[model samples]
Target chain A: MKKAVFIKEGQVAIKDAPMPEIIEQDDAVIRVVRTCVCGSDLWAYRGDDAKEAGSDNSGHEIIGIVEKVGAAINTVKAGDFVIAPFTHGCGHCAACRAGFEGGCQSHSAATNFSNGYQAEYVRYTHADWSLVKIPGQPDDYSEGMLKSFLALADVMPTGYHAARVANVKAGDTVAVVGDGAVGLCAVIAAKLRGAKRIIIMSRHEDRQQLALEFGATDVVAERGEEGIAKVLELTNGDGVDAALECVGTHLSTETAIAIARPGAVVGRVGVPHTGDINVGDYFMKNTIFAGGPASVTTYDKAVLLKAVLDGDINPGKVFTQTYKLSDIDQAYKDMQERKTIKAMITID
Target chain B: MKKAVFIKEGQVAIKDAPMPEIIEQDDAVIRVVRTCVCGSDLWAYRGDDAKEAGSDNSGHEIIGIVEKVGAAINTVKAGDFVIAPFTHGCGHCAACRAGFEGGCQSHSAATNFSNGYQAEYVRYTHADWSLVKIPGQPDDYSEGMLKSFLALADVMPTGYHAARVANVKAGDTVAVVGDGAVGLCAVIAAKLRGAKRIIIMSRHEDRQQLALEFGATDVVAERGEEGIAKVLELTNGDGVDAALECVGTHLSTETAIAIARPGAVVGRVGVPHTGDINVGDYFMKNTIFAGGPASVTTYDKAVLLKAVLDGDINPGKVFTQTYKLSDIDQAYKDMQERKTIKAMITID
Candidate 1:
């Protein structure tokens, strides 16, 4: 089997690797159908994350078909198409039962699951709890619907998590602080929540256009203080009711905080690059900072899946570029260079 | 008029000061009938907060009789007894209307209203917006009622603000990270909000007693990680639903986050002595960091006031020590030395 491997900083390649097999009672072997490059992947690609080059499996978001199921797996069967949440969990843990599967006590993103989905086959543990079966036959869905289904695995659910935790309401003015796939999807999520006005902070024309198409009412190309100023101006100087900090940089978080109204919530979903949160800045403003890795398994995937099927939201529009598994290197390059908003990978 | 002055970092003295008079259309002159030393005041007394000795007015919490009212002051008039929120606001600003008087547009804690309540007469700006009437004649209430009324000015209201922003819902298990007046009051607030169990972290026997009396179901004397461990153990290892960081130190905030359940809210009302918030710690925990300087003027003062009048709560019990106007130095010393939980100063 061929899987994406990290050769070194600024390098990723598809190489021959051993095939994954069901090793646990709840494990399942899946044939990879679709996968994608997440913003967090760039951390290791850039050598910022402590992940050693050419070590461990890569990629988390996955949409695949169950080729085999372990003895204990009852929820999913062979030949079923499924969406795998980025983080796997044990269904019966206290945290999982409380709807925080991402922080599940039995198995978590930081501790378990090692195979990457950018390959012909992958092993998924706790399949019954970690995988949600897609409704309907694969042949009945359109290509766009398939792409949107792939989003439910990570990006779309993550964006919805941002909007949900920020408490975006029907009359709220929302600001999304990134223009990447998750940020664009957040625009869709905010609109779904009935936001009165949606502002996207983006510097690139393509992303800005995608943002508007996804439901952004306005776009601010400025960065830092200027971007905050633009948002404040649009909000009549009171600032937006909710802000989604989808870019993990300190500046992005600061801008999100600065452009939020008193008592507004700034929900941050991006993998953070910095550890500092200016206590004085948020303390004085009465801002509520909420968010983390999205608990995709806990989100109302059925509702979002329905929305996609019903043509209410096209989160798949974020896939501005796509490539086969053989072109994984180029896909990473396009995404790293900001030449593509997001790259979708088709596995055969 | 006699008022308390900070002669030096470790010194406070009652000395003659100019009598206050209404200077603005929305201003009112109040005769200080009761005032108390706040936990935040200890910051300057301990030389932690930067304050030039004898440089500015001192004290913020006060219960007083309206000595006189400006032409525009409609909510309060001469002879009315009222409780003043520590922070004053214009009331008509967007932030104020949003129930964040601490961040009011026209006037804020950062910009104006420096006159302290530890004086015979103090000028209160935005009188109509900052003052809450006691709903009865001063002579009709008992001494305990007056002390409880004084709590409404800062401690009680600030504690309620912490619980309110933390989103304490019925059946929630709440952990208070401090056991001072504010923390004890937070216990009361949590109970009023229908929290199922309240845990207070405190080593002092007196404070722990007060916490239990105020409705704490458990008390953990441990500090730092040990404290968090105790809280987690008490909650059957799931951690509390809401954590109130009533102590401003970074350790307190970190502990608050550490002991909170995933998706829990850590409400902080302590005047922050540290400016750092570890984004990674909270980001991974899915913790919602909410709170700031309490917008006491926006709180349901009428309900709290009625509670006190009806003997439903005895927040005044936190005021374990009292002093005459001339004993201002002793009051500061006792509070600074932790000999008393809080100090009440009689200005008559």
Candidate 2:
């Protein structure tokens, strides 16, 4: 099997690796059909995260076809096209039942997909609960639909999680604090939730235009205090009813909190890069702070899959550039250099 | 007029002060009918909070007779028996209309009652929206009823804020991290919100009994990690659905977050005495953190007043000791030394 490996800082290589097999009674072997490089992958690529050099596995999102299943896996069968959610919930735990599979009590490393989904073959555990079977194989759908299905594996649900956690409601004015792929998806999510207006902070021209097309009502091309000022100005100084923080830096987190109105919520989906937050800021305004990894399994099984099937959302647009599996290094390079919004990888 | 003054650490005194008069067109002069020493007062009494000695105007809670009104004060008038909430909201601001008057954008010092409600008279600005007029004068109600009304001025509404922020629902299990007047009141708040079980953390025997009387279903007399462990044990290790932080220290706040189940909310009503919080702790569990000063003006007008008048609650029970206005020093001493849960001050 060909899998993506972290060679060292600033380098990722597709190398021949041992094929994955069904190790757990609930596990299944999947032949990867589609995968993508995530923004979080850049953290290690830039030498910011603590991932060790020469680590073999990478990537957490995937749309795959089940090649084999353990005897105990009854829900999914071989030859089934499936979406493997990043957080593989067991479906019965309190956390999973409550729609927070990201914090599943019965979670194991196998459920995390840390073995690298950006490969020709991968092992999926908790298959019965985590794998959402698509109605047909990848060849049955348009290119756009396939990308949207792949998105349900992680980013789309993550974006929706931000909107849900922020308690976005009809008639709310929302401010999104990043212009990355996830933030663009959040714009679509905000619209799906019926937000009256969405002001996205973006400095990149292409990203800003994409955000507008994705349902952002306005854009603020500023950063820091200036960005907050611009957002507040757009809302007539009342700040936004909900703020979506899609960037993980301290400044981004602070901007999200600052842009929220009194009694508003700041939904932070970005992985935090900073240590501590001055909670007194939220306390003084009575702002609600909530967010974490997307409950992809729950959302996919509940709404995202149906929404995608029904054409209610087209998250596939986030992938501005695509590449064959052999061009993996170039895909990472383009995304890292800000040359692409997101990179989609096609496997053979 | 006589009013409570901070003499120094461990000391408070009743001294002559200027009589209050309607200073703003939206102001009203309320002759204090009843007042009380607050738990927050003990912070200053213990010299933990910065305060200049001999500074007058100490208390914030009051149920009184409106003695005079500025020309614009039409909602409340002279001779009207009123519950002057600790936060005097203008009622028309965005924060107030949203039921979060504690962060009212139109706030002024007069609306805060920082001039002192323990005095013979208080000049309450934002009177039109800030004061809740009772049906009759103080003489028409029993001492218990008056005490309940006084509780609505701050503690009861403040406690209710915690439960409201925690999003407590019917059949939910709630954990309260403090056992002071506010925490005990929160026990009642949780019950009123239809929580199936209420766990209160209290080491004091008297307070534990009082908490039980106030609807606490269980008591954990432990502290720190052990306290969290006990709470988890009470909930069968799933942790409470909602955790109320009535104590503002870092440890208390951490305990509230630690004992909540995945995706639960930690409602903190206590004024935070610490600086920063490790937000990652909350992010990991998708726990919602929401709280601040009670929107006393909003809660009192919306529900607390009716609840008290209907005899649905008797928050007055929190006042375990009584003191003549002249014995202000002893009142502070008793509350500081933990000799009483709360002290009621009577003005003659």
Candidate 3:
């Protein structure tokens, strides 16, 4: 089976990799229907071995049909449609019980080659817990926004979780840093969560425009001091009640902190690389800093799936382009160039 | 009016600073009855120039009797008894609405010591919002463990808030780093929150013993990697479900992270100085980090006050010694020398 693998630093390729099979009684083998590039996947693609790395099947945000299941598996079975979150997790791990599905303990979800998630057909472990079965076949798969659901599977809920952790409230103003898909998602999320005003800080015109559509009550095009000042200006010089950082860069993280009013919270979901996780401003501001990776598995993914299924939300807007599994390089280039927000690929 | 001012680092003396008056339409003048030395005070006492030179009003934790009120003030009036949390707060601020009362906008409890609680007669700016009045007590000053409430005014509730921020649940195993008053209080708070097994990481026999009395199921005297190893060993090598860092040192902060299982939360209430706020392990461990200066005002202090008042909990055990207000120098010395866990100074 053709699968994506990281040959070395700065290289990703679709090569003939070994097919996967059920290893646990609660395991199932899923034939990949679709896969996509995630911001978290860029760490190794960009030669940054800092945040996460692996060569295994590189995609966990998968939409697939279960090809087979173990004898003991009961929740999901052969021929069932499902949305696989970024991790294959055991339901019983402390981390799993604590409401973090991405850190599932039983089945390693990283590169099976090294610790990747991209593959043709990969073994889905702890099937009862890891796979979210999509109910009743729809006439149009694209209409279902399955690709978007795959995308939403992690970053979307992550944005919402960031807001939840920061405890953003109704009539409160929240500023979002980093106009990545997650940031864009957070704009919608903060609005959905009842924030009276949502602000997005970004220089990208496209993202800024998207931020507005997604529910950014305001957008700050400035960076650093100017950006912080702009946020405070929108917030009556008191700063935001909550700041959501969706971009993992140092500048974005610090802006989230600097723009925070004292006692407010800064929810950071961006995966930071080599940079100071500054807490000096964080301490002086006396702010609550919450958020890590999204606990995609711990909470109910069905709610998000239903939103996508019902067309109430269209997260698929993030996938601005697409590619065949073999044209993975162009997909990477398109994403790196920022010409595309994200890319979807056909596994077949 | 007589006020206690820090003339310089390590030099504290009572002097005629400024007459108490309403600075804002919402201000009030409170006749401070008892203001205790807070753990956070040691920051300024150890020569924080910003505090020493700015507004040397030394305490944020105070129990006082309201002497005067602005016409607009409605929460309390002349002769009302109250306890001020660590920071002066305006109840109407966005930060306050979001439940972060420590960083209120209308009244900044202590921006600098230019205005402080550590004075004979203190001027409270957000008198309507910042003060919590004691119920049913006008003259019974010495009966309700006001000193303990004052002592915990910052640390205890701060510790409780730290655990709350970490999202500790019943049946969860939690590890507490730091054996100071905050740390000790965290042990009880963790138990109150239904933590099944509370572990205290400390070398001090007194603190460790107190932790046991406070409902800690286990105590670890080891430090650093070894201490973390013990914590992991106790949890069958996975690590505690939640960990709290009440001591804000780099070591304690690192240990809190080290001992937390992936997907677990490391709630750090410790006030950090210059130290590596390590995220390398956190990014991989995928630990959720939350907590900063606790929002004691965000919690039900009255319930805690009742607990102290009813003697359901004896947080007063922390006050090992007391001195007359004239012997405050000795109180500091006792606390500094570790001869007393905490010392109270009485004013006649």
Best by TM-score: 2
Error of 2 at B35 (Å): 0.3
User: Candidate 3 versus the native: TM-score?
Assistant: 0.85
- If you assessed candidate 2 against the hidden native complex, which CAPRI class would it receive? medium
Error of 3 at A22 (Å): 5.1
Let me know the TM-score candidate 2 reaches against the reference structure: 0.97
For model 2, the stretches where C-alpha displacement exceeds 4 angstroms are: A108-115, B108-115
lDDT of 2 by residue, B111-200 (tens): 554446677888887888888889978889999998899999889998999999898989999999999999999998999889999999
lDDT of 3 at B33: 68
iRMS, candidate 2, in Å: value is 1.7
TM-score of every candidate: 0.95, 0.97, 0.85
Judged by DockQ cut-offs, the docking class of candidate 3 is acceptable
DockQ of each: 0.56, 0.63, 0.42
Model 2, position B258, has a per-residue lDDT of: 88
Q: Kindly list the per-residue Cα lDDT of model 1 for residues B1-348, writing each as its tens digit.
A: 988877778888778889988788888888888888877776778887778767544688888889899999888888998998777877776677777777776775553443467888888887887888888776888888888989988889789989999989899899998988999999999998899999999999999998998899999999988888888899888888899989888889889888987778889998676556766556777889889878787774546877887888899999999899788778888988899999998875
- Clash pairs, candidate 1, are none
lDDT (CA) per prediction: 0.83, 0.86, 0.71
Q: What is the TM-score of chain B alone in each candidate?
A: 0.96, 0.97, 0.89
- Count clashing pairs, candidate 2: 0
Best candidate (score: lDDT): 2
True contacts kept of 3: 0.43
lDDT of 3 at B184: 88
